[model samples]
Target: MSQKSLEEQIQQLDEQLSSSVEHQEREAKFAVEANERFARNIACFEKYYPQIATAISEYKVREDFCIHVTTTGVGNFVPKNHHAPIYGDDPISQVSAQVEYGIQHPTFSATDYTASPILEDDKRIHIRYMGALTKAFQEIQAEQKERLTVLPEHFPSAMIFGIGLGYHIDLLLEKTSFDYCFLIEPDFEVFFASLFCTDWFSIIEKVDERGGSLFFQLGADEQTFIQDLETLADDIGAFSVVRSFCYQHTPLPEIIELIQQWSSQYFRFQYGHGFFNDAITGLAHTVHLVEKNTPVLTLPKQKRVDLSTPIFIVGNGPSLDEAEEFIRENADKAIIFAAGTAIASLSKKGIDCDFHILVERPYYNYKVFGDFLPPEEYKKTNLIGLNTLYPDTTDRYKWSGVAGKGNEAGTFLLEVVSQTLNNKGIPLMPYCNPVVANTALSFAMFSGFKNIYLFGIDNGNLPTGEHHSKDSIYRNNLDDENEEGLVCMGMNGKYLPANFGGQVESNDLFMGAHFQLEKLIAHYPNRTVYNIGNGAKLKGAHPVRAEELLPLPEANRDINEQVEFLKSDFFEQFNLEEFDDTLLGVKAFNEICDHVLGLAKEPVSSVKEASDNLLRQARYVYAIRNTALHHLHHMIKGALLYYHCPMLSLLYTYTDEQFTLESYAKVNTLWQGYIIEMKEYYQHNYRTKCDHGKD
Candidate 1:
């Protein structure tokens, strides 16, 4: 009886063994197919995005992370640091349902849809028209909340926060497409695992077929994710990213933090749009300066003078009042350069700057300078500024030099002129922006100054709300009552860590300057920058109180001779006659105008179509690379983004197709008119209307 029972048990055991063997065979087959797909995906990335391809190729897989195949033949990831699977039992159904629900009940409110209106008192034709257009669109947006109930069929941009097994991406693409898709995976291991499970090759192909861009932020952590995204938005068009459908695949802590950072910093892309009139004015001023034989401030060929002579970059902040005695006592010890209206403050304190730097391009800046300081005060001070500085203002200084401002039409023109006359072009100043102190610091860095000292560059306000020094032109213009909260409101209207340990109120402009100063300071690792003021805390700068400031030895070198040597080493004078033929010809200008006009005039049936049209327009302008009209692209790109972003926002926000199309039509008509006006201005008036200075 026992022998028969044993035979039966052996038969059952053999059947079970056979079943196990088959399961192993099936799993091996799955692994082979997954590897094949991963190879194909890597090949696709190599063709399109080599960076991601290289990262995946170089990735070292974690020992504990394994791809677990479920009973239903779906892959799930188990991370080394995690206790459980990234996806539960049924990843397919779970992701499918998530995608379906996400599509039907989408979350679009994550972005700041508020449009930044052009509020500057600019008289340029484009600025005025865009301002009016912005106001009109804002009125339209005011009605969006009541009507925006459904999500649009398509979007210009899509951001995938996490890629667990990458199933949601496939599901998303199956439903709709995006002009630009940014896929962010903070953990390289997760992304690498997804390569085996998901058909990324097909995804890249589908996106490519639809004329879309796919950006991979593989291995990007929370700290750098937002900055990388911002940089991508900048390289592409910021307007194209007006509305993006954010799909969060996994709710990891890192992913959540990245989303929060993005939500907070997205507004940065909306600001700093260069409008048309400013472009024209900058061009005119630059051309006039070049024609007048004004020297262009350039990078030094070699470190001719000892940079140890501590150069002080002075700003007209309230901290200047406290540091006046220290600065005055050490005036001869260090070369002082006054930033913007700081000259007036320094003059009031009977301090003379070696160089007075101004950045604003308008004629009013020149007029204001004259009003603040008499010619006698700055007679010994050298004038250093952007190429767009008013030509008449340069005439009042002892000597003058200019540098090319980044992303300016005037800068491009100067580059062209330089290229035509000489084989080389000027390099734009790095981190020069939003404030005069930035330009001063950039100049100091560019000139190879090793020991740079920042005084009174209070990129914030005192607790009492005094932003500028009492003797500053701002305070002189205002009575005591009007002196409070004197600074212009910035993006982050809050307090920041101050140099001396207390908080100081800051705004967008000051915050931008603070960030730029930190970046510049970090950029020159060889230089030591000391901040001696109650300003916002700079990351890479050493902070010292005025009382603690160690006395620097008086420069052994002849200061005047050093200044002359710098002028000779880093300044160039170009022949104005050489630039006559270098200006963008009428044909090329008209061609660009026509391209924009064509995009504006294109018929759009849906919000998606209109969004694509605007994207195409932005891409077209930005794509005018290495041409004379390339600078024109920079000038127009910002205004285009400023106008197009809000327009697209309205089109997407309004659910009704008819209303959306109607709004698009009205905006398109206005855009057409603007382009026509711009074309006319460039064709008929550009050469003759240098009335700001040349005429």
Candidate 2:
């Protein structure tokens, strides 16, 4: 036993330990744990998933522990040397304890499936569970809706959750139509069994012959599956459908759960994935904001409303029909406000709403005033909206109070003006909801309305398939047409059904607004809020039936009094120096742009160096906002976002692209040209304002 021989002996013992049952068991436990983790991720799949089994088997496990093929009439070896279950004693059982909706892989039991001697007329051999595979075929037949309707031809891509012996997959290919099919089989053993049991080669050839795409994600973790899905989704370019299938008597609950969770997350990502685009769009709107001299008001010096004043916010939901009479009878009892297009509905009914809260800036939205109301109606009601609102709509109101747009772009523009003019811009409201209802709600909160009653704020449609009250533009448009889409959860956690035979639809406009309103109301516990509607539920707001709302005391307030207060507080009085600040600010911004242009032309060796320099230039441009040049800083901020973010993205994404001096020159030239154009436009405005003299 020399030193070399002793080392060899130790190596041999190490090899034996690695091959021991304890090591194998630990590995099996790790696999089970991984599967469990995957199962947990699957529990939150989309609501659109099928509720029935959809898989069938092409191979059978006989009593002899061999895979008996029905498709190819072949027998294959399934390793059974390790008698211990690969997944554990109860693989599918753990899924029940883990998730509300999840799938667990069935245990590999040879005795469970029985082989049949009889063959179909097509010469296909028969496999069975207790002598017949009728139940499996029947399960798939019940899920014809999923294969045919849910995974329709319209969707270019299809994601299959369970590949249980490839039965459901076979039906999906032959029964339905799609450009591509993505098979996600989470269980390695199940997929392996399918390979040995079925004629997968012929299936692939058939799919290829049809000129359709087929991708397989086998035994993948959550991350791997998600990444594959994302790439597939990107390639498919939207409308990628997802469906789940489980084999009869051998369902893959874990995989089904995974698909569910994936679909939910994918939808969430799609919903809120627009930061850079928003900034770009906001920059475009900032130009419109300045051109109109839209009376961009900063916050008033003091709160206008008494915090105790009861306020009623009226929406255009169908529930408003019932509230119309109550609002009319007690018109003066509370500070009545109409949100978004609700103004049209209330005005059509001859109900005098005190304030028309208009937050949306679209030209189409302004039709609520143009198409629905007369000029007299617009004049009578006070208008409160974002400063970024269309000037055509805002100018119609005799008394208007504007708040900052509340987005990053709107805030940037307002903040720059505030810094330059030494006037604190109107209080910024959170535009978290993409809908005008939330805008009205934000303004209500801004005006110090404590006890607020929301009327017709039904975030959904009525039973008659009406989204808005009669006389509304929405109702008028859909009067003769029947279309479906827009689904939101009801108060009872089930889908709110519509009269048109589908779930009540909720677009981004309503959903975003509802969520924002919920958050806003949640902040104030003592301030009582009531939703006087039977539409979509608003959490944290007590529901008050329209009939229950009583009218009593006359309001001590008048519209003119509030109108005068708003004008006196928010109206901007101009001076000559302020005009000079605008001119000088534009000059300073151009100078910074020129400086950055010069930097871009300088030789840079690495992507990091170029990116760092560009970023530094962006920061320097941003810093100029703090100076007297701040009047034009809004444009500077916009320019910085436009240039900086894309540059950073390119830097990270295309690090391998060699930074050429010529490329820098091209980019610098582009920005320089854009800034010059903006400067000339501002110069024209400055000259015109200068000629107008003091106002």
Candidate 3:
């Protein structure tokens, strides 16, 4: 009522007006920028090169880093171009429809196939399919070879998640060099088929061609994915990415345990029942985007290109002896890329590598590289490996992140290599064997060169038997090698390791190294490839003998205009920083939501639909509200391993831990609410179906 009080109210009103106006202005500006970036992102993938875009979405991106950069959609939650296989039925099937690729729980029944699998081991039909697979594998290599240069200048490797036959797989293997290959084939029938149809030798050679590796993929079903995880727990600490897909029908608690275990095991975990984000996140960050192409990272008036000497790749298959003459004659003319073990032999035989693509991942067998290297030459030679040891391995073992002590070595190896190369190896294409074909072809695409020459990349089952003749390690895993491990050569030696100790093959480098390589090459396809090894078969059963082909001179390939453009403006202009603000906002949003925890909670908007998609991130957020994630993982698993109504358990299953601190009671409350509702609905639905059947 006093004059002073009246003035105070007026002052407060004025402040509110200013703040509101400022906030609105900021919001409007943000909206415009967001739309622009989204448009650019789309254009980068669609107009410039659509396949590159799709491949990057699946092969090059990494979720933890790329999620913050941008979202698929801008105006609303829905995106304009839905990238990938989305399951939608006319009447809306919810999780039922989207779970097409889903693996069933171990105890679950299989869908009735009108035609059951033929148990008769018909040698004739099997041999014919084997012939077809072999031929298809070779031709695929040729096609990928011709298509390598089609990519824009960003990604450096290539990765194909699953095999639908050996078409895409063999294409990458024989064609070029990828940093690493990640292959995941969970089907038993296909696993056996690969044993005969696949020429895994070429995959090993291709991995050797580039400084990369190869690994396997496995998905978690309720029973098996977990059991397998535990079985492979000690060995799985070195994966690049642990990926899975599950639907609502899957036991929710089991899924949580699987994710937690994977994360703690020094692996990057990715999952999607039917979401594009899961795949894209892994591919985007794995890419090594260059300044010559992306406006996002481009600088003004960048020095375009400089013609450099042609580099020759030297592999260690039996085909090595075949290329001896050609390499010896042109020894002084070009750069030689020696595969892992081939280094020692070739270097001794007066065929020294100018740039060694050191792809070996094991501790014992990989040491052979040191024997070959002149220590002075080691510093000068381009020592390429997966992001396992660059800038050195000191940082990974110092208890970084949430990973346990068991995962220290694997994590360090990856961190070291990821930070190793500047941008020279920006675009590398892989020439993997049948085992790692996709990864090899992916690398060939990214290495910035238009022409890739592959030697000793013999994809045929090694002539001396299953093992590569050049390798002394007995390195590759012969059985699971075709299935769960895209994993390249393992550590071989007499010395036992200190931890579990003894001659155990390291599985850590399989997923992490190779997956990164595939993503790189998938985006950069200009540097296409051709296999010159005797066993580097393409187009038919017979290998393409490099001895028969005419060789090209080195001087002609030196002055490529593209390379110059890449080097000049790529560093200063291309600003990864521009996307940092956007990334921060995304991280904040995720922190509040909890990534994996959301899947375990009740959805407000649509329960059935949300359950089908089953978000993992939200569930992670929910879990963070309480006991350590490591401990809660086991607790949650024990409580919900079997099918108990989640809603019922949350309401009264009663964990002894304090529910108040972590909102456990609230979760229980909502979980029980869903169950009671579901019980009533099930009765109604049962009656309705019965009535319909009677009619």
Best by TM-score: 1
Predicted candidate 2 versus true structure: per-residue lDDT over 162-240, tens digit per residue: 6655544554455444445667777655665554334455566676776556767666666456655655543332223
Itemize residue pairs with steric clashes in candidate 1: 490-507, 490-508, 491-508
Tell me, by lDDT, which candidate is best: 1
Model 2 CA RMSD to the hidden true structure, in angstroms:
20.3
Q: Rate the local accuracy (lDDT) of all candidates.
A: 0.77, 0.52, 0.34
Candidate 1, 330: how far from true, in Å? 1.6
Candidate 1 off by > 4 Å: 1-26, 62-65, 109-122, 142-145, 476-492, 500-502, 687-695
Span of 10 residues, lowest total lDDT, candidate 1:
686-695
TM-score of 2: 0.48
Ranking by lDDT: 1, 2, 3
Candidate 3 positional error at 1, Å: 99
Measured with C-alpha atoms, the lDDT of residue 374 in candidate 1 is 71
Off by over 4 Å in 2: 1-305, 360-368, 408-425, 475-504, 556-695
lDDT of 2 at 111: 13
| lDDT tens per residue, model 3, 1-695 | 99999999999999999977766665566466654544454453354346634543454222321111112211211111323222222212333232322322211111111122333343222223323333433333333222111221111223343332233455434343333244544432332223222344444455655545454443434334433443332232211122121112222343356444434432322110111111111112112221111222112243334324444555555556666778788766555556555565576566666444432222333343444455664553443333222212112121101110111222222222323432421222232311223333333233344555566544333333333434322244556544431234532321212111122122323333323333334445444455565342332112246567566665644433333343334422233322222211223333332323344454543322322222232234235323323222221221221111222112121122233113333443333343243233322221111111111
Q: Model 3 compared with the native: what TM-score?
A: 0.34
